[model samples]
Target: MSISITMIIFSVLFLVFIIRLIKTATFTLEYSLMWLAIGTIMLVFSIFPQIPEYFANLFGFETMSNFLLVMAVLFSLLQLIIFTKYTTKQTDDIKSLIQEVSILKEKVKKEE
Candidate 1:
């Protein structure tokens, strides 16, 4: 039970889960793309275990695991920021819609 083998198994399972989510409409394709890409990259690195090590050394990481951990953290943070921005925009849009409806209701009330 090597780390590489474990990674490969988990990556495949992750990809399958993402695909199933997309198929069932539980997760939108747009959001699932990032997860799919991550899973694919994990699978690739697992199959060719040397790639991460090479990149880790090239990037001055103390170890491949450290490099992977840093990259995953950075990627997750970026995704969180993007989703936050999206949520803010949606909130603003919803507020604007509510205001418009409120104004329309007021006008209807006056007419009545």
Candidate 2:
């Protein structure tokens, strides 16, 4: 109904897509599983009448629709932030690992 609501619904769908992508992508098992769980949980919670009702009315067709959209947007943003952080950490780790390997190679060459 409203812009925020539309955004939220779109966002939720986006999160689900991200989860699937993660599963297929080269990310580690733990990371992929974690994202999948997070996406599913968010989707389930949003659909569950009792949960959404606690904070605000979720039964009205237009209202619920709008609310859902907003929720989706918030969830998507949160996931993105988390994903970015994980990527940054992973990148740094790879760099560190590369350095370690280079040092090991040099050490092996010297001892030979």
Clashing pairs in 1: none
lDDT at 88 for candidate 1? 100
RMSD of each: 1.0, 6.8
| Candidate with maximal lDDT | 1
Please write out the lDDT profile of model 2 over residues 9-96, one tens digit for every residue: 7659968787677768766777677766766666666456456555456345346557767877987898899889989999999999
Once fitted onto the true fold, the runs of candidate 2 whose alpha carbons sit more than 4 angstroms away are: 1-54, 57-62
Candidate 1 residue runs with Cα over 4 Å from true position: none
Global local distance difference test of model 2: 0.73
Q: Score each candidate by Cα lDDT.
A: 0.92, 0.73
Deviation from native of the Cα of residue 93 in model 2, angstroms: 0.3
User: For residues 61-108, could you state the per-residue lDDT of candidate 1 as single tens digits?
Assistant: 999899999998999899899999999999999999999999999999
lDDT of 1 at 48: 98
